[model samples]
Target: MNSMSVWEATANERPKRPVLQGEKTCDVVIVGGGFTGLSVAYHLQQRNVETVVLEKGVVGGGASGRNGGEVLIGYVESMRSLAKKYGRAAARQMFQMSLDSIDLIERIIQEEDIACDFQRNGNLLAAYKPSHLDDLKREQQFLYEAYQFESKIVEKEDLHTELDSSFYHGAFVDERSAIFHPLNYCLGLAKAVERRGGTIYEHSQATKIERVTPDKVIVETHNGRIVAQQVGLFVNAYTTGLHDVIDRAIVPVESIVLATEPLPPALCQQLIKHNRAASDTKRLLYYFRRTADNRMVFGGSGRTASKRDARTLFDKLREGMVTVFPTLKDAKVEYKWSGKVGFTFERIPYIGQLEDGTHFAFGYAGHGAAMSTLLGKLVALNMLNEGDRHNPLDRSRLKPIPFHSQHARAVGIMKYYFKFLDYIS
Candidate 1:
């Protein structure tokens, strides 16, 4: 299999923007050109605010462009779990924001005229074990009662209608969840930002962010610097070394993904007839779906701490794909790749402003596609001094993760523990 992302290989052509050359100034300086940063720029331009975005690489080169392309609703944790942890009223607001995030994505796609193969077929959450069927049922009920969103649950007997294989015990399909070409969407957003007179500099990695004063900061790149009233640290997984507070509060883990060569149209239909984006009920979940071009793309949350583990991830992913769809034992994996997901101990995304007047938003864990885009709007509103009291994520500042340096080892131990549990279940 090739060692590259399918999205990168098949994405549409766009003009290459120039790099940062000299010092510049803007009202707001956004670090990282991924979804969050681009979204921040997009929303700021809506209010005609002068903004500058500095990306280390091309736009969407991070998780924003390299994810599973599933525009899902809700957090990584379930609504019931959120309610139990943060009260029902808080959970309801968070759930509503997730729904609104999905709507924002659709609106941006239509308004910007971005053609990234956007589709609303659906997203199926599959049960990996027989006992997990009840969990899916409860989730369906909770979605309907709490959010008024109805999802269809399929039992083992009728599961074949949704999935071709018998690997899953049952499943629930959310009609509102959708999928698209993520990298293209990011590229489209960048263009849209430029069209609105917002400035963007590619190959402009911010190496140091100096808080010159409480009210303003200076973001320095390799070749230039930025003087701004405030800075937004939206780098997500790449936040390490950018700022100590953000890096300490977050843990970044890598997940590998693979895409098979185009298969027969009939075989593709037999694999996933509805073409829904599907993920299983596992601690280290498996996400799989059929591409618009008839390729079976599969991915999993497998940690790669070293170079050796990175090599093994490809094999594990292939084994996983075959186990789910035995018919694909002979299918060729044309592309293999990986990206980092920002995780927090609390298991909830945060949007907070540091003491230096720098605003930030991250720790999506595994769900960042729509949520990252939504955070851009919230952060922008905060930048504009518009009331952000409605934003549930803006309640308080973030606390640092305990033993941040040992997070990798902790995650490795948890992986083995969860693997053992999965084996037992």
Candidate 2:
């Protein structure tokens, strides 16, 4: 029962970086060395912009490495839900960008020669109930008719060939997505940034952000400070004690993950025979896949970040795993850990600059791998002014969450409502 995320435990050794010990300067200072910041840095270096990334912990120590590594296409919300919220045109445009983001990941991996076990086996969305299957059918139709996207809907009888489970009513499989070793990818991205003449400081957390002028900002860590013409804050759920307004804009949610010990190859084939990443159609959906080593990496159950009880959540996750695949009842979970991601209203991710002339990108609702990479590139474009500086995903500015202190309670209440909805459906 190790607390280490299977990603970090299995990833290649991350090079040790020195802490910032004195005043340093760069064209852009990026806070948080996770996916977004690294992506921004990587792109900035591509344009030969002097950049420095400061991470509170090691690279990929946050959700960048802790995620389920789905590398999924599109936003967390379905195309229908996105269309209903932001109109069909806007939703379609965003969907295209989301798809492009996956391309960016693939291109980078090939260009950088990063050995992260990158695979394009795609992903599956399973229907836990008959009604859920209907929803999947409608979603599949809407994707093709409205957005010109294609997905295959598997009937209940044929679901087992793909999922090896009789628990699901049906499934929707999208072949455009991918899965990989996220920690390795993050480390590779950092290496790419450095190879392009950028510096990344590990174990150096930005403690204070002081805006000296409209174009000058000073980011201070415990031992040193960074003076930069522009600053980008990519800290997602780990934004606490950085900026109150930015923190309030996001509702931090905990994501618990566990990886079972390597199963027999026969049992592994009895599981995900096609090796596609999968998630169910529940509000608190469980996302899982078979690792390169035949271990089942299953993750789900989000609570407010402040209310992380990994022990209980891990137990529930195991129970859910057994519920879906009874053959895993005796499987031993070798790794268990948890991390956080920003969840915004309407499940829309945000990217914007604050009043003090600092840029930021957050609010991914736990489905941020591709978006973070794309948003980081867009943010870099904003800094370089190469073209349109406007971000389609930006909501102008962040709206401070009302009753911020009671967010945990709100999440708790909503969890129950979602559970009920799952039950009835």
Clash count list over all predictions: 0, 0
Tell me the TM-score of model 1: 0.97
Superposing all C-alpha atoms, what RMSD in Å does each candidate have to the true structure? 1.3, 1.7
**Residue 237 of candidate 1: its Cα lDDT?**
84
54-171 per-residue lDDT for model 2 (tens digits)? 9998999999999999888877778898888888878888899889989999999999999888889888999989998999899999999997788999999998889768988999
Whole-model lDDT values for every prediction: 0.88, 0.87
How many Å off is the CA of 183 in candidate 2?
A: 0.7
Off by over 4 Å in 1: none
- At residue 314, candidate 2 shows an lDDT of 78
How much lDDT does candidate 2 score?
Answer: 0.87
Worst 10 residues of 2 by lDDT: 302-311
Roughly what TM-score does model 2 have, to 2 decimal places?
A: 0.97
